[model samples]
Target: MEIIVTPTAEHLELDAARLNSHPQNESRLFPDGEVYVQLESVADIESALVVHSGQPCPNQGLAYLYGLLDLLTKHDVLITLCFTYVPYGMQDKSFYPGTVNYARALLDHVTRYPVRQVYAIDPHFSHRDWVAEYPVSHLHAFPLVQQRVNADLDDYVVVGPDLGAVERFGIPSYEKTRNGAYEVELEGGLDIEGRNVLVFDDLIETGGTMVAAYDRLKSQGADTVVAAAVHGVLDEGIQRVQGTYDGLYLTNTIETDAGNVATESLVQTALE
Candidate 1:
């Protein structure tokens, strides 16, 4: 399959697409607030894309993606997408009527094209069945996490921070109460005295949950309490997670400082 890394997704440096080959892939804007885009040499081929929908400019990213899709769909190219960081993925649920589930909304918009499959690294969703009708599948980052832990971390047990994580990872978990968007309280017991603890989850936004987990584990006499997550989207989290924990391990999904694992290999894992 011919692979494409869109102009919006150029920062990932995936081996699949060579940006230099498509010198004509450029963008401009109209006098009005509109975007003009062009992607060269991607027509009439089966293709895979690499892109991340990170913030501060998410609308621009999707606009560029839609541009590329418009050009490629002309020749009926089969497409697969690697959304490294899904935009608005955390908004997967709605508690009230008329509340939009942005996750589902984005999925609908993404599948409007002839996409065969979609691979995301540990997508944040409350349930899988809610999106089973879509061609989206999660790329498990836990295997890579296990490899990293086995190579560097010793005498540590993987602990899920809440029931959702417990169901996803099938490990011992902590009871958590969320007071607000940035406030977290954890309650649980484990025989972890003098042993290292690794709290695993999909994403961390404000770092409140991880910090609460760290405090709970340390209070139980654990030697080291580390935080591990696939996506490090720390908007206001760097301070809360940096000095408070023994260590933080994350993947290159969002290009954060704590990202130690390369998600390139894990992308290939999706094909398997």
Candidate 2:
């Protein structure tokens, strides 16, 4: 029931007050570029939940993660790893001949350490078999983001950016057309005319999908468009989509100024 946070996870500001609190874990280099880890207090722990933000700085963050995992396994502590934004998550869908799936490869590397279970928030992987093996627990920030956002907002509809989402969310979604403008066919009994639109995806690296959805929704006579996602690895995407959408939000999965929503509720239930 103890929560051990990595340096990168500090951005999440996770609300795990219900879980047992322990001394912070420390990490530094050995001058050879190798990572070293330590517990601020004595390591008499039994069960632990290691929360880490694994994007933006995957290599450095992973060094800390592996070091911490190595240290904990020595104490025979039961571990459940939580990566707010799973690394190498994008390559799980479709494969190229003679190439390896980095997503599965890296996740396998993680499971190598005596880890019991791993969890992530809205992983980008769509490969059914790979996802079935170890997905993000099918947990998402949609409901939480929806609940926290202003309810007095305009009439809203969730736009699935892909066919998988269109089937999954059972709502009208947008697809790309030959002309580069997104097309919304108005399925699932929801129309974009004069109503606010909400479109989301697992990750928002460039914000093109969201911004495009906004443009298409407005073209279809929608009032306003709110863009959202679970992870906002938004390097330059933030500046690009800032003023265009009526609202923009990302869960605090990565360390960014724009992560307005929190991801604690989705995780607490599993830990307890």
Candidate 3:
């Protein structure tokens, strides 16, 4: 038997509904915001699949994951972690003085557990040395976003929010653009005038650059602006832009109130 555990029931609801035979743990939270797992009593459990939707409280989620690992390891069960959004993944570099390598730190901490494998979606790390303990499956977010974009939107041009995203969205060189904290810069002097645009990025934390780019595209006469990302860690960024955007679509990676595109199938395949 394979048991699926997550920090919250909501995180694994879609998966559980799909995999009806797999046993699962429902997480409960105390008044103090501590997380606890309620496991269904079973025998002959061979492995534990810990699914994590790293948002709202990533540390608390980690605590639950660690606790589950401890319990399962005592029974000599194999363990795998399917973390949709790696916490502090963007902190891959010490940009300047007083900065810490949070990516390394987080990877180091998680690998301390006896995890047989780790699965993540488009982790931002440029190096893989931190994950030396176990094999990691790095999944791409582009195909997921592309399928949704093609199915939902018509008459839209995909806009990469940064130079790095140009290849991901397959935008033409002339159409490529770059977004900074407060300004949007054109790579090939392209104009978004009178065109419907879809802004794409790997993740949305604070939504600063995306918001700025949306406003700038409108200023340059874009007919409509929509956004899509792999992870939606909105962090007041969605509230900051309120009613201005036509739509916002995201995968169930970090789990916000955004329109969710299913990723449970991806998770199932990863487990296999």
Candidate 4:
């Protein structure tokens, strides 16, 4: 299938049209040639993705869904919504007071049309088995994320911002730190006094935890602190750390204005 991708000033643009000649749909074919045509458009595709749900804050996953919907609507494609939930994240339980039924509500909304499956990436609760109610496709991201990390780094310590992330990240070499905070430690807890450090996480929101990690690493004698995440959810008031760290990297799973971050090129390449 041929795909065309466009980028709006503030959103994702997708237009897809089938280009194969068919006997039944002669009207869609070019007069001089024999190419069938279909059109699909999508805007802001990165907004609704939610890879992580703890530590920093909630990155709005709805925006990513909106963009996906736009593309699916145009192409008449069907998919299952996929996500991951941290152990103590708000979406973990429905028993908590005032907690929203995120799974149900999200499924209800997405299934309104052509969604054929629903997937969760290592959801916290065993009861998450209920997600199968709508033809679900539950999957895990740890293996994928681990594969990516293995390809990127030869030897690096995995640092979790807090206890919750320690379990969620599930890296055997993971180290836990305070919530929304960070600390630097050298060999044997001694100060590094001047070294480079790499910190990785699943999501970043409000820039609090990341910023705190940066500060802690610097204080522990690290000369530079570089951070990376799968999702960059720079909520309002948290964008102030745009250029503060040595390097802040994130995927295009969510749109942000931070420099030096990277996004998946699938959509872009598909358009070309």
In order of appearance, the predictions have TM-scores of 0.87, 0.83, 0.78, 0.51
TM-score of model 1 vs. true structure: 0.87
lDDT score at residue 242, model 3, on the 0-100 scale: 40
Candidate 3, residue 76: the lDDT equals 77
Q: Once superposed on the true structure, which residue ranges of model 4 sit more than 4 Å away at CA?
A: 1-92, 112-114, 118-156, 172-195, 235-238, 259-272
Tens-digit lDDT track of model 1 for 53-146:
4543667767767776677677677777777778788888785898988888888887888877888778887355688888887778888877
- Which regions of candidate 1 fall more than 4 Å away from where they truly are? 18-35, 54-56, 270-272
What is the alpha-carbon lDDT for the whole of candidate 2? 0.69
Compare candidates 1 and 4 on lDDT and give the better one: 1
Clashes of each: 0, 0, 0, 14
lDDT (10s digit) by residue, model 3, range 74-169: 777777877778877778777799998887777676677778788887776634465554477787766777788778777888776665565444
Off by over 4 Å in 3: 1-3, 15-27, 30-33, 37-43, 126-134, 164-188
**Model 4 TM:** 0.51
- Residues 1-272, candidate 2, lDDT per residue (tens digit)? 78778877865556431212233433265557665667643266888888877777788888888878887888888888887888777776447788777778878887888777887777776435656675346566678778756564655777765555654445567554333333223323237697777777666766566666666677778887777777877667765566678777778888888878878776665586
Give me the candidate number with maximum TM-score: 1
Candidate 1, lDDT over the whole model: 0.74
Candidate 4 lDDT trough over 10 residues, lowest sum: 4-13
lDDT of each: 0.74, 0.69, 0.67, 0.45
Model 3: lDDT equals 0.67
After superposition, the stretches of candidate 2 with alpha carbons farther than 4 Å from their true spots are 14-27, 30-33, 40-42, 150-152, 167-170, 177-190
